[model samples]
Target: MLTTILFNPEIEHYDFGPGHAFRGERFASFRRMYQETLAHNPHFQWASHDESATDEELGLWHTQDYINMLRAASLAEDDEDSSVPEFAALFGCGPKTGPSRQSLSVYVSRDNLNPLTGRLPEGIENAARAIVKNSMLAVDYVLQGKTDKAVGLGGGLHHAKANYGEGFCIYNDVVIAARYAMKAYGLERILILDTDAHAGNGTCEAFYNDPGILFIDVHQTGIYPGTGLIEETGAGKGKGFTVNIPLKSGSGDAEYERIFDEIIFPLAREFRPRLIIRNGGSDPHFADNLTGLGLTLAGFWMIGDKVRRLSDELCRGKCVDLICSGYNPDVLAGAWISLIAGLSGIKVELKEPVPRIAADEPAEIADIIYEVRKVIKPYWKCLG
Candidate 1:
């Protein structure tokens, strides 16, 4: 049975404010979709997350200094007259400079703000721990032979770095879970498939030199965090282990499918991973305001099914999904539910058909894919 972990209470504390694209209501919308749609599927098993990670557990993938900084911010009790501006600026909390979307901008809210000192709650650290702990629990279940596939719907914080948070992510839960799987569970050669609209910069950084973890990110080009170029393969021992396919703007379902057929599937066959972790972000949907890529619910379902098939074929059916980013509440909710249903092997009635590829679009994307394969062919065993 598939075990799906939903940290409902943790969702309460993961607020990014009203106008922000990364609002907590997205989770609520997903939960509602599951209840109304996928709950009836017999093959799916839904699990709720009750436990959280301690600092010791978090230390597995994060630095102590960074963790301490988060703690200080959360507690609202200053460390010997530590100024807020000093810590906030260092932690990326000051006025936004990069992207200029009004919907994307969010100031500290009253609920999140510390009343005594007029500062934001230590929510980032708490949310980060919640993400890591929930992911660890899901990993443990899969490793112990409790479930072959699991989904941690609340924690996908991919933008979180080893030292600080960015792009609404804090603590890099996927990395921690991957580390836990390798160190505690004795799994070798873990594969991370990050399909977030934005590049998984933090995850790439975490495993940049680690050869054991195979990282593949298929993101939109020229987006937030400004990384994940096709040439930015892993360094040192991980030279060929990191693979990126940054799709051009407006590249949708056909582009994604071609990448899978030509690159992702073949590479997975070569690497032969023991476990697969999917960074399932649905923000690439055409309706999303944050991204430029145009994908529909059908595209997400197809990708989810493809990942499930890959797990069954390559990793003895061991896979876990960490929900990443998706801003449009309704579309994100629908896409996430579809992914869960698809991964769990449930029969879903299509609300909308997969977007059709124009005659010229596939070739356009294929040209890009061909160029990418040429660049990374040296790393793969038989791509050349």
Candidate 2:
């Protein structure tokens, strides 16, 4: 398979703090996995590189004022207080329930935990730029017909809004890239498939009424930044285009497969987007402390297969599988590697024992699926 992945070692500079959930080590672990995978699969061909996004490109989705706030946060004030009032307003960073440091910009050391004490590392901008640039690069690869698929290894960062960034996310990368594809690449239909444990609120918000983008997110209900209710379909002409499946906590692989076979597949066939950008977060894995879903590594593999099939059948194999959230180091590493295995058209059945976690009661999962179908049925003829 011809695939392109946008990545760089410096992007790991986008670290929050010592104890934050979105740690820099996550990428380091993935890098280790990448090296091991290449060693094993010598024939596997992938184009990987580092790319940066300019200020103008960021404005594609973010407001100028919001961009300025992030810029200021990237720099520490001379007062040594390190607090930017605007940063708090934008990212909810303040005294309690926020970063340990009062500083707006993070100037961490090589460990990404110690402060460099020189120029505060502008890792947020560096990481956010990678997200946006990789997203766009993935699109470019498909548009140019160089590859049928790509992977921009980063978070969906779906919690960010057009005007502000929040929920461990600095900017909405998927939305900016979708907009880029539409305006620059002349593609009319795009789908944002977010299977994160948390709702893809920012992505849904960006295209709620735009009709051109179909946002279907299946997430654990009542999580942080909760907003993906079944009734919260798109507004105005965008109604029916926005599909949200609010799965109950503890829902597992069986429940996910049911939704895909029943709802997502049908909807995608009807909508027929030119590109599908999947925010493939592994936080739903059973081992993660951050989420309640019990999705196993095998489940992650299935999703990669499903995405590949969708791309091949619907969008001429034009798909980008972005690496999103997953906190547990061991489980996250396995889940992501298996996902890539599936994307490469290889079956994944790990020799290691699968971790066990609670599965949502079958009846409860069924009920939620039924509820989602009921609401989306109004907008789509395939639901029936």
Clashes of each: 2, 2
Poorest lDDT segment (10 consecutive residues) of candidate 2: 105-114
1-384: candidate 1 lDDT, tens digit per residue: 565554636755666554455666676677677778877666566777568888888888777766765554554433333333444533545442111111112322233333354343446557657778888887887878788778886667887776766777767789999998999978889999998888998899999998899899999888787999889889998898888888887877778888888988999999999999998577888777687787777778888888889999998888988885787665777778767766776666657424434422333787778878888888887697
Q: After superposing candidate 1, which stretches have Cα over 4 Å from the reference?
A: 1-3, 6-8, 77-122, 350-363
Q: All candidates' TM-scores?
A: 0.86, 0.87
Task: Output the number of the TM-score-best candidate.
Answer: 2
Residue-level lDDT of model 2, residues 181-282, one tens digit each, is: 898989999989998888988888889998998899988888877799989899999998888888777787888899889888999999999999888667
